[model samples]
Target: MGVSPQQHERESFRADLDGNVRAHALRCAPIAEALSGATRASRIYGIRRFFGYFREAAGAGWVLLGDAGHFKDPAGGRGIGDAFHQAERLADAVGDAIGSDVRLDHAVAEFGRWRYRTYAEYYGLAADLGVAGPIAGIVPRVVRGLHARGRIDGVLNLLSHRASVLDVLTPARVLGATGGHLLRAPGRRHATLGELGRLATTEIRRRNAMRKPVFQSGPAPRPVQQETPEPELSR
Candidate 1:
């Protein structure tokens, strides 16, 4: 159900969903009928952009895990895996604190640091995938080109959450792949160069934006207190 906003006009996309369902129904009649019966209760949930991090992730006796700690767009489909990873990490830290002389606060803080270090690249990748922008166009074309050249395993690994974005898309690897493509297909040299150039420019802009601090003209606002029993940890 998820799609790039840039690739689909809102109304047309919604209209096409019925046709798509019907097409699927043609292949599987029974399922189609069931789906049709369920249509009345079905409601559209529009796509949303979500990428956020808390400046701190642990406080007092509590720490956060999964979406409670960090969240990115659903487009990446990394939530479940990320949750499991975070849970395991938090459990390890808590176990260490309970079993040894280490302070719970210090152990939890270390867990938070590890979580950010491990998932920062994935977060960036998820943001890029979820946002409707030039990267949307660039990524598909790059993947297609790499697929044609039988060199798309890295990208596939990244999408499947089997590899970190940084590991898969390192500068040296990018340059090597682009250079190989240029050498192997002389006709596509210009296009390859252009795509790499655009990608580099986009990355630079993104990094610069990340480096720029948000300016607030007034006094800093107080942190909102949560009413829940468990403290809501942010990271």
Candidate 2:
């Protein structure tokens, strides 16, 4: 996958079930020698972002779950885990509604709130990674520096969705790293700061936009009534 300022491109190949790996080998010749006589097969897919928000998740007796409720870029490979987490929360909400006298609709609303709270930081991180720009260049360097300092575990934990973005990439840590880089490459400091500012501004806009309501709920319309037959006239 390659992210550029204009777009993101993901390319991969798949093999047939009959163990015909020749096509993949031909397409990916760099690894052809290693793939010689390989019997396993695999598939590939592209992940894209369709960022959105829904004001309400419950209406009448129905509720949305998983991707139907929210989705983010798959670049982080957190889709499955996110879906599972949503399902667990939804189940808990449903169970409480069923076991107690609470209204299911209210429980579902609470579920949506919980989902937003849990997914907000990860969503921002995924959005940042999905787009190309200065961040693309700076983030890798930052990670490398963290690794050199033996603090890469924090980054790894963030990638694994085990820690919040702020916890891993705190403002102070980011500033310190940026300062060090600036000192080492004083000539590029201006460009780096410009890009970092743009990235931060973009993220702020995205986060605010996400909070805006994208759905509305109202009472269902009444069913239409049928006209009475003229049976009396026939009689």
Candidate 3:
């Protein structure tokens, strides 16, 4: 994605409500009584959000959580948890810096360096999934890979009511040293929200312009907005 205005807005919206929509869609679906005992369904145009959490070290080794540093798509219900987790990690370092006289600046600088890996992991997952909706192509490979091992096991791992979107997107083997091969074999290894969103939108618009309804079925599914994503049966 070349980063257009509308795409920017869609990404912004996904940070909260829109992200939730994507999260919910990943959930399993149920058969509707009205659908002749069938279960396949599609969810479109719902609010979703993707979240990002971070803190910056202030002067004198003081740290302040940037107000806009946290983001989430209400679609997944994971933002607040992510923010708190970051805060917890930072709190210890902050406390250590304040309570001890052991060269505070050096300790604070070390904290950032040591925490770099964790921060990258958190940010990477959110960045990929946050834009997942707009970049449908990115998901197919990951989702299909999950299918081989039954139920897309790693897609969503919520434990104690905490969501882990990071584990859902990139499996370890695919993301590490082997990732270079993936880049070489592809049409495009990475995708952007703006590009994918515009592609989806343009296709839909073209279909409408041609007066062609994409649905091949006899009728549409009953529109009931659910809190969770459409079930696997629908996919």
- TM-scores for all candidates? 0.62, 0.66, 0.39
Q: Model 3: which ten-residue window has the lowest total lDDT?
A: 213-222
Model 3, span 99-214: residue lDDT tens: 56555666666555544434333444444444533544445555665677785555555321233444454436234313543565555444433444554464455435334212
- Per residue, candidate 2 scores C-alpha lDDT tens digits across 74-123 of 56778788778778878977885774445787788787777766677677
- Predicted candidate 2, C-alpha RMSD: 14.1
lDDT of 3: 0.43
Clashes of each: 1, 0, 35
Candidate 3 residues lying further than 4 Å off, grouped into runs, are 1-55, 66-77, 94-98, 114-116, 132-134, 150-153, 157-235
TM-score-best of 2 and 3 = 2
Error of 2 at 100 (Å): 4.4
Ranking by TM-score: 2, 1, 3
Global Cα lDDT for candidate 2: 0.62
Using lDDT as the measure, name the better of candidate 1 and candidate 3.
1
Kindly give the stretch of ten consecutive residues in candidate 2 with the minimal lDDT sum: 9-18
